[model samples]
Target: MLLTQADIDGAVGDLSGVMRRTPMIASRTLSERIGCDVWLKCENLQRTGSFKPRGAYLRISRLTPEERVRGVVAASAGNHAQGVAWSATQLGITARVYMPTGAALPKIAATKAYGAEVVLEGTTVDEALVAARRYAEETGAVLIHPFDHLDIVAGQATVGVEILEQLPDVDAIVVPLGGGGLLAGILAAVKPRRPDVTVVGVQAAEAAAWPRSLAQGHPIAVTAMNTIADGIAVARPGDIPFAHVSRFVDAVVTVNEESLSTALLLMLERAKLVVEPAGVAGVAAIMSGAVDLSGRVCVVASGGNIDPLLLSHVSTHGLTAAGRFLTVSATVSDRPGGLIALLELLRDLGTNVVDVVHSRVANGLELDEVAVTVSVETRGPEHQREVCGALSEAGFLRE
Candidate 1:
């Protein structure tokens, strides 16, 4: 049976005090870009740096006394593991988490800090889940299946409840889809009373599974996953959440890897928010024009736990994709004044030089010619074109 409004209310009560009422603030930047009044449901600031704890806390708190005694076991690449660990810690229950060997070190350390014993195994979350299941069976511990149980759905639905309370006239809600717990929960909670509100789900293009699953009327596992949005890079939609998605979600769309990086950059630079690639999927959808939304729109910024190294790399990629950073390779005179002349030209054009690579050792290069690659930062797309035109005009363009 589909979750009722009462189920959502129950979750709200269960989450009282324990859950952080994350902000729902207006965004002028996104509003102008999307041609709608935009609001952000910043679950990135939620405890555990994600919306995972909402469901995790409620699910673990509702455990039977016997189950609580046996503790809980969970498998996750990042967010879910921290959620279960934190929830179990609060309720004085033992928790064991199985994380992929490739899981980020910060996330693994965070899970361990939450008082859960973490076991690293295999290469992906799917493999870690197998280990978690076996451990649960062997130890008789309750397994916390992320996004697959109704109780978890109920918990995630609270996000919808909060949105309506915050933005009663909201016309559309864009959410990130992985196993579909967040989207399903929001749909269940929002659709009952506000059936007019259009709900859309966004996924990383490489890891998307919902579109096929909804089309087939069943959960279909995506065979391959290569995305920086690893938190939402789920291989398959969960059966329970898939039912809700099939019945309720208006549309499921995807954003490419470049779009994900750009969205993260947008959040960092424009919104002053640090969001993970998975969390920013909704924003990426809007930025990529994957979803045509208007009126008052709300996008859930889902999580903020990202590796610093990955953040640095994605930041550079985002800059390049947005045309805010440019690399120009040009062959300049080997004499001392040639490189200086190019630098002066860039300076006069008001571009900030990122770096310069001067090399005289290419196979076809004349002894008097030095090939130099100059990287500079531009304002945007228009500025990028201006910079390129100026270089080509100055006889420094390399093909």
Candidate 2:
């Protein structure tokens, strides 16, 4: 479908009363670090804790009354399911959603709470999508696509319009690309208004299928892989979205898991925002040095539907990546004063003890010795190395 400026403007007008005009907040820390003015489009704080509701609500609102009465069906990993369910509820329409069994519990609960009939059908989104399609055909329900549809694309385009208004001099925008709706919409709206503004897309390195798909000029199914950024863990790119992405998107970069965790942590600690892994992928790309931003930049934090457990893990991972957490094992004598002496040595190096595990028989140490695992929190790698050196000098054989 041809996505013109008129089409985008009309969609924005139709949904203006329903959708939010989310704020565009500046990130001084990021701007100073990257040598560019950086703004964070915090869509993670949107109505459904994601930007999906913008497209979902617009799509459902535009449907005919008969279609709404027939109900809507959709398949999503998490965020889209919540968006569709919430949007359907707003339109007073019955919604049936199929989600992978492995989808985050918080997301499942949120979707169900939004008044949709949630179905746990498969282990992967692809499997759930197949079931959703079959159910839609059998029940004659209007199938609302998560990202591929023209209406959905137009709906998401409103974000670009908001960004333009918020930061007219925005030199570039970096978006997290999954099924490509967000990227496509932003590109459609931004490129037309400011043709020179660079539009970049980011994807989880482990689940990056768009690069290969774009190279082949078709939507290719990336193997459904596990990633912390479940929101953008799409196996395939949308056909309609792909068209716009190819035309206007300046660059598509991939960031690793470490980068994602670090970015999320930074958002929580420095930016005072709770961003999910997917929401932070744009910043992850920036931190990973995958994209060059020499001018004003916008990083779209797409969602904040992170699981509590996952957040804990991401936090720990971030600390570890930043060298604030360290784990090392050493062999010490079995005598009574040996463990205390080792502790004293660590204290001398100014390393704070966080956790310690003493193993005697299980670690296969000699009968006269034991393996002691120490987990310490230090200032950084230099402090950690200094502590390790102190241990070694104290005659603790480290592994």
Candidate 3:
């Protein structure tokens, strides 16, 4: 069914009490960087740490009493699983969630904590979704799809409506695209009221489907999807969302892995927000100049349910991508003083040493030589270059 403005509004009304009114905060740092008034729609702070409940609750609530009695099942890497679990608990219905075997530990724990029977299966969300479907068929349970239904689209549309209410004068809405539910819902709600408003969808370059699908005039599934943003790693766009996105979205932009890491770091260090990689795709687009928004813009931070271990890795990656971190290897004298001297040199050169490792009896090491590797923190790209040049000049940098 086509998601009309009236349907979206009805969802908004239905969700007023159940869903949190997530904040829309202005970003001064981003505004200065992008040359436009920038605001963040903090859905990462919403219930279940995502915008999923807006749609999940609305869809489940509309179920007939008989359907509710049979229980609900869903497949998600994390966010949507938690949403369905939380919503089901609220409505006094049992929930069973199928998650990928490699899904984040925290998300799996959270989903179970929200009172769902958690089943770990497959290696990807699509695989888990297949399990959900079979369970639904076998047990007569309601399958709560992550995205793809009319009610789901309408429920997510409420986010767009809330954005317009919070920032009526905003000129553009930048949404992170996965299955296109969020982007489609936003376009349905925003474009109807403000036809002039620009609605753009941001997708991860590694696993993006909208660009290819839009070009081909049909939904095409991507194979071997791999990206840090597991939340938005949809292999294909849902039919409902694909139709809405094709008709109403002004533009769709893609951001690479480096930009995504950098944007997540920017939010953590600058905005002090713990946003997931998928949630920062919109910010990544702005930071990387993938999308040029010349007017007031609101970038939706779609989720915050990130694995801490992954965050640790992404933080190092972000630092390296921003030129704030570096690793160097060299051959040094096989003595304790040699390591101390290298550390001193780094300290004198205004670089902070993060870690140091040494190895002897290696292929390239002589009897008196040891392989030394150092990880250091720098200020920026120029600073890193300067440090590397200094090390090279001192004959301590290997290649």
Candidate 4:
């Protein structure tokens, strides 16, 4: 079904009480760095910690009473599962969510916490979706797809309506695309209203389907799919979304793992927001120079349901990418006073110690000599260099 502004408005009306009117915040630091006005659509703060709720609620709300009574089933890796589960709880309906076995722990816990029956089915979303379909058929429940249906597209489009109302002069919009529902809905709504605005779709480099799908003139299942952005790691594009994307979207770009990590860190440290890898793909594209934005740019932070352990790792990865975390190995005498002198030198260089590991047997060091590994936090690359130089000058030879 072709999505229209009327559909977007109707979805917005249907979701008024159920969903939040997520905030649009301006970024001074990003604006200065990009040489243009930058704003963030903070959907990471949305109910269920992702924009998936917008589409999930809209689709589920349209189901008939009989369908709701029969219950609903869905297949998802993370955000979509939580969205459907939360919507089901609100409507007092039963929901069964099928997720991949290796799905994030936080996503699995959150979905179950929302009063849904959770099943760890397969290693891939496609496999889990098959199981969900079988369950839906065996039982008389409605199957709520993540991004393929018209109602889902209509619901996701409501975000575009809010964005245009919040920033009338929005010159560009960068959105993360999975099956194309979010991009389709936004383009269907925004392109008609503002023809001059550039709408850019971003995808994970490891699981990019839109670019290939567009070239093939139809949806093609990707051969290999792997990425940290599990939220947008769709193996195939939806036909409805592909039609809208081919017509309305200005461009589609892919971002690498390093760029994704960098963007995630920037959001956490600079924007003070916790965003998942999929949530930061839009920012990743901009940071990696994949999509150029010369004027007003708005990046959609899509979700924030990242596991704490994964968040911890991504934080360190981001810091390492920014040269804020520095690791240095040195060979020092196994004596206690030798380690004390190195610690003093690090303090004198204004470096904050993060972690330390001492090894002698592992590296085949003599009993009198030990390999001291230190993790330090510095301001930037320059500061990191200063720390290394100070260690060398203190006669602690870095191995």
| Segments in model 4 whose C-alpha atoms lie over 4 Å from true places | 362-368, 392-399
lDDT by residue for model 1 (271-373), tens: 9999999999999999889999989999999999999999999999999999999998888899979999999999999899989998989667888998888
TM-score of each: 0.98, 0.97, 0.98, 0.94
lDDT of 3 by residue, 1-399 (tens): 578767987998899888999999999999999899999999999999999998899999999999999999999999999999999999999999999999999999999999999999999899999999999999999999999999999989999999999999989999999998888899999987899999899999899888989999989999978899999999989999998999888999899999999999999999999999999999999999999888899999999999999999999999999999999997777776987777888999899888888889667777988888899999999999999898888878766
RMSD of 3: 1.2
Q: For model 3, what is the error of residue 122's alpha carbon versus the real structure, in angstroms, after optimal superposition? A: 1.0
Off by over 4 Å in 3: none
Give the poorly placed runs of model 1, Cα more than 4 Å off.
Answer: none
**Pairs in steric clash, model 2:** none
What is the lDDT, from 0 to 100, of the residue 30 in candidate 2?
Answer: 90
Q: What is the lDDT of candidate 1?
A: 0.93
TM-score of 3: 0.98
lDDT of 3 at 399: 65
Model 4, span 1-399: residue lDDT tens? 688767878998998888888899998878887788999999999999999889998888888998989999999998899999999888889999999999998899999999899999988888899999999999998999998898989888988999999999999999999988889988988998899999999999999988888887889889888788889998999888998999888999999887888899999888999999999999999888898898889999989889888888888988998889999987778887878888888898998988988877756677798888899999999998888887788767654
What's the lDDT for residue 168 in model 4? 90
**Which has the better TM-score: candidate 3, or candidate 4?**
3
Residue range 1-399, candidate 2, lDDT tens digits: 659878898888988778778889999989887788999998988898999998999899888988988999999989999999999998899999999988999999999999999999988777888898999899989899988898899989999999999998889999999999999999998897799998899999988989998888888998767789888888888889999998888889999999999899889989999999999999998887899887889899999999999999999999888778888888888998989988888787777888999988755678999888888888887887787777777778654
TM-score of candidate 4 to 2 decimals = 0.94
Q: Weakest 10 consecutive residues, lDDT, candidate 4?
A: 390-399
